[model samples]
Target: MSNVEIRPVTPADHSVWLQLWQAYLHFYDTELPAETSALAWQRFLDPTEPTHATLAWRGNQAIGLGQWIFHRSNWTVSHNCYLQDLFVQPDVRCGGVGRQLIEHVLTQARNAGSTNVHWLTQATNHTAMRLYDQMAKRSGFVQYRHAL
Candidate 1:
């Protein structure tokens, strides 16, 4: 962990980013259009885009990614950060990579004066939920969605 640096995602990281990005969607049983992924990569590079990405590195290699965005929350009357995607290489679990990414994002949200950082995961993803439960209180709001 000492060697790992969590920094902004760069344009050169596109190729590796796509593989991890796609894996994250697959793990959730979701399909993301390649074009959309491309747009997200581009958005990360664009200073004007609200999108911000952080990549975890152990020296020169990228092993994980966290994509986050900020928006005003009417309920909180302040901005909030949404950690839209977080994934670490399957081989690297329990090495504190995910925890570090989460902590880093939470810090970012706080530094931005955000009321909170939030995200939703599949209810069946117990491993992830367990970790989240430890970090924050469960909001207990049932989630529903319909794909058009």
Candidate 2:
């Protein structure tokens, strides 16, 4: 983790970012439309958009990714940051890369005056939960969503 560098995604990062993005989706057994993914990439590169993305690199190889969005919340006057996605190469799991990526998002949210940062994970993702437990308290809120 000490040697890893976490930075905002750039146009030059498209190929590597797409590789990690696909892997992240596959990990959750989810499949999104290609156009949706393309749109997301475009949004990440748009400065005016609230969506943002970051990649963790070890040398020239990308090992992890963090994507977040900032938006208004009724719960507070300050903006809230939603950590929409987080992923690390399977081989690099538990080696602090994930933590570094999370910390990077947290720092960004703080700098932007966001009140808090939140994210979701499947209940079966116990390994990631172990690390998450150390970084944040459980909110005790269940999520219910209906697709349009």
Off by over 4 Å in 1: none
Estimated TM-score for each candidate: 0.92, 0.99
- The stretch of ten residues in a row with the least summed lDDT in candidate 1 is 1-10
Residue by residue across 56-108, what tens digits does model 2's lDDT show?
99999999999999999998999999999999999999999999999999999
Query: C-alpha displacement of 63 in model 2, angstroms?
Result: 0.6
* lDDT of each residue in 21-42, candidate 1, tens digit only: 8888888788978788888888
RMSD of each: 1.3, 0.5
Local error of candidate 1 at 121, Å? 0.9
User: Which candidate number has the best lDDT?
Assistant: 2
Pairs clashing in candidate 2?
none
